[model samples]
Target chain A: MKGWIYQLKSVRKDKFCIMSFFLPVLVAILLNFAGSIDLSSLGELQFVLTAGDLTSETTEWLARYGTVMICQTEEELISEINDPSTNLIGIEKDGKGIKTILSGDEWAILQQAAGTLPLLYEQRESSAQVGVQILSRPDILAGYQHIFAAMTLVVAMFMGCTFNAMNIISEKEEGVVFINEILPMSPKEYLIQKIGIGFVFGCLSALITAAICFRLPFARAAVMLALLVLSAFVSSLIGLFIGRFSNGLMIGVVYIKLVMIVFMAVPMISYLAGVENRILTFLSYLIPSSATLEGIMDLANGGTAMAGKDTVILAVHGIVWFLLYLLLAGRGKKQA
Target chain B: MWNHNKGNRDPARTNHRLTGKSCKTRSIWKSLRSLLQKDFRMMRSGKFFAVALGSLLLYTLFIHFAYVRFMDMEIYQVYLYDPAGTQRNVSPLVHPVASLEEMDRILHKDANSVGIHVTDGKPEVSLYTASKKLDRHRSDYALSLLHPGGKYTPETVGGNNLEQKNRRDITCELLFIEIVAVGFLGIASVLFKEKQMGVMRVHAILPLPKSLFLFSKIFLFLATDLVFAILLVLCNVGLSGTGKILPGLLIQTTILSLVMALTVFGCAMILKDFRQFSLAYLVIALFVTAPVFLSANTSIKMTWIRFHPFYHIYMGLKHAFFGIPVANPLYYLCAAGAVVLLFGIVKTAFCREMEKEG
Candidate 1:
């Protein structure tokens, strides 16, 4: 444990390592600030939309200023146009041109009236016509949040893994492994220390993400932290295992980069494509970042704890990957 | 004496014959088997299967106890206003307020309501317009309210209601998220393990085709992901309902699985270590994922996001869930192109990885 602490401390002392811990947090925070801008815009759009419904003081004011035309028929509508107190009350008949013949400013007045209120006019043809497309606001917001959550998970996981993955390869290339190798520890201990360091780094990054990108209550924050720890551990194991297998920085780079694209990016693609199925959900537990993302989504949705299933899924996933990492490390001994 | 016997047999033209391509194919299989065997052995100690099983159990429990329960709360709080008694026949479920100010307040507080205001004795509805797609729905609702029980009822296609829609929608998202993010890591983590042991490089000099090394892992991940998908859908969305859509969903999942695996394989080869990879992952999660999620799931619209590749993927998944066929040939073409492109990149990266100095 002392040896582990010493190694972690030494890693922190390195400027690059220090930057690795903070950069994602900074980015997440920046993005959070940016996301908040959308919130304000959403608020503005909401206000504008709802504003149109409220008693249009202007309509009442217009009643005193302009000629009011209240007519049920086209001829009456035409006659009332000159009389000023005109409002139209008539059904637009199907397959016919305004049915009743009305001359003068009736057409112009009706056209002008149609502009203010939600008006429907009949276009006469053999087939009936009803406007056929509609969408709800909440559904729109839900879609936005869905996509946002996916993107957040992707970016967060990518940053989380890349920084951790690079450290392993870069250090190996720099012969930094020698220092740890020289210490009085087995390869297992060494691997464990590195994994621990990555976990801590991930925790810090997740905190940064939670703090800057989202604001949650303490209960939610704790749940998020727990998820971050597991996610980071799994990611670290992947990085360390890849670093161990790789011959140099080049191989290491390829390995980690591909992992991010496949594991992290594709899930978001699934989301973009609007797939909803139990199979995808089940698969979600298999991916380390998926849990992190789910957790983040729960937090984003104002939930304090991750849905019980997501937490268990992520935890199990992390443990599984960690063990696989160990086995791989053991195999590393034969080649080394 | 042995050489004479063999020469004599050959001179006699024994029935034992072989084609070069068949020989190549057999050797390729042998190589694949060996590679898969080695990976399986390595992954065993790593408890890969155990983890999967545990994840299955855990996710099952959580879904039953947590996720399903949590999502069972309420629908969008709908608020309506018509002062002239125009909607006397409107459903009582629709909350009718006396004034427009009340509607504004409710919408403001709700932030997610479809606001309907009858002004100048004509009903005009307003909602936070998020997408061009949603604009159509708003218009339909506004027009529908004008005549209660009108003949313009939208034809029922699939049996999914609003809640079921949410269920399937979220399920698909979680699944996609899992395969894309988690499966990618699974392949990488396993490969990274092998790579660290210098076994990947060893495969290069083997008598078998090198592609099998990548294929075996992809196959394993694809299978695992597919299985997980099956269970998740069956368990959450119900067996009977998901049954009809399973085959199509599986095909879509497979396509996604292969594409993501190849892409990650290429990326893992090109990047440095977990740290650097994590940074890249972060960038991807933030940028690529952010725009896709924002555009797909939220009210925030980026007109440019329609051009994004994942946007189509997300919409495709959504369509797939609702039993909608991804009828666009162009979509399939683009997805195939992406997969092929990623595969080529992975092959190139694999060669480069093989050439790297120890």
Candidate 2:
């Protein structure tokens, strides 16, 4: 109870810590705004650049594709092509044919469109023979919005790891650990209190983030909350391990960087890319953050949020890291 | 008292005073050198350089083995179900599906894939839609495959193929992230260590200017980042064209490194502990940098991104990677002015920190 009170008092004192609690809400709102943008109007044949002399018919033919901006010189065309902001493709008259100038990061479709312009212009009359009808199906995971939300939630949970790690490290730096040595609480109890506080904060951050980002049914929200609690349990254990081993804040930062990359970045990338590789799948399952993210994503996608593979994985991870922390704490007690 | 007065009037006393001034200058140089060495040692002990090397290796490997290969995968796979065999001249890239059920299964598995169902002679495209614009592109690409013989033979201007472009683009982005995120944290962690150790307070009583303390750390980080930029570019961008881009790349890197290092230095001085600094870092990483990336890389347009300082720095780095000189005088002027301003703020913060009671 004393430990919890101490932790709460420290959190209350730190204004930045309080601000971090609201970060996920801010990010979720930004993502919502981003999702609301009308993306259909973009990349619909707007600007194509050309230089040098072309007959009136050629110019008229080019006009069918998009608004053709004619540059007086090849230098000017090249200049426009080099501009990073402009999505212009430059065409210059070459002997009997034309050459395309690209900024090189143009979309594959845009590149193909530019490449096939001459042929498309040549067969403009007969190009309508084969008809195209687009049958649009409803996407299960709608757009990047859900994915972004899931990422935000995962980030929010992981912030617990940072908090716990910094908490212990700062205690050591401030000579609080020495004081704790003379206190009545056992090292094991102290560890529990630290992890418990982190877990509580983690759940709070996750809950706030989910509240802003999603409107799930009660059962689903309960399952998500359970999964988040498990995630926080594992994250706190990892933080305890980092704080125990690292000598200073600098080393702790490095460890956190590595942890975030392995646990957060790799899984997020795999999820976004829809990678089907078995090794990657296995790796993601093994990592606690990845499994938790997968569970949250499943829930967000309207999957039945019950005891599933991700739940088992996260539970197992919590057990494993907990055992490891106990063993390290025991070893430190023996050494002392 | 008479001997003291005689000595003060002596020529040797004047020579002694000149030597004393030179000794003071030499002592400042010595102090700066020792501070740099101490920081370097601390960084070494903290494994900062090791982590940097590891990151370099990881990034290089990902670029060569993963990112390039992943990018090389077809953007949208196109499947065609043509029972009448009307489209004889379809592109080989499009897979021929046996039945509508098979097309449905494939499309279900690969949501990004587009299916063209040809009945009689007309082709109808079906797919899980991404965006209206992207869906249109996928359908058009599917239709374009019908006339595979109609080739596009436009000459590429810069002559850099797709692979080269991807390499440069990804390298530039990773390097920027490394400097902005990792480098910023790296300086903070180091400074926080000094603060934790009471060394900063000791420096307050020393006969050295506090700004040299800031300068030494900044110089060390700047050099390290510049070296990292060189290696990352050389390894990923390759040797063929590195020469042309290195100068501009290094200049932009120096500006970014100094700005990040100094900013973090100031923050670390002001913030009480690593926990608070971590919160600040989180804010900067998510709020400050994320928007810059989204606006620059994606179609998501922000009308006010132009006002964001990091946006220009990011664009400047990108332009340098593509060998485009930022000809705007205002950019360089602004960057220099910002660096000077940050330096002033950091110095003031350092002074305040030094004055604070432990």
Q: What share of the true interface contacts does each candidate keep?
A: 0.06, 0.37
Worst 10 residues of 1 chain A by lDDT: A43-52
Q: If scored against the real structure, what TM-score would every candidate get?
A: 0.51, 0.87
Locate the minimum summed-lDDT window of 10 residues in model 1 chain B: B149-158
Which CAPRI tier for candidate 1? Answer: incorrect
**Model 1 lDDT, residue A169, Cα:** 70
Measured against the true two-chain complex, the DockQ scores of the candidates, in the order shown, are 0.06, 0.38
TM-score of chain B of each: 0.71, 0.88
- Weakest lDDT window of 10 consecutive positions for candidate 2 chain A: A38-47
Alpha carbon lDDT of residue A194, candidate 1? 70
For B1-358, candidate 1 gives per-residue lDDT tens digits of: 9988777776334443546567777877887877678777766655556555555565567566755554432223456677777666654436778787887778765554566766565656655655443343334434444443422211122244434655675677777766666455556666666666677777777666557777887787778778988887887778887888888788788788788778677767887544444445545554666567656654454677778887787677766776767788999898989888887788888878877732
| Candidate 2 structure quality by residue, lDDT tens digits, B66-141 | 8877674335688999999999988887899999999999988888788889887878878776655455555666
Q: After superposition, how far is residue A221 of candidate 1 from its true place, in Å?
A: 20
Once superposed on the true structure, which residue ranges of model 1 sit more than 4 Å away at CA?
A1-19, A25-336, B1-24, B58-158
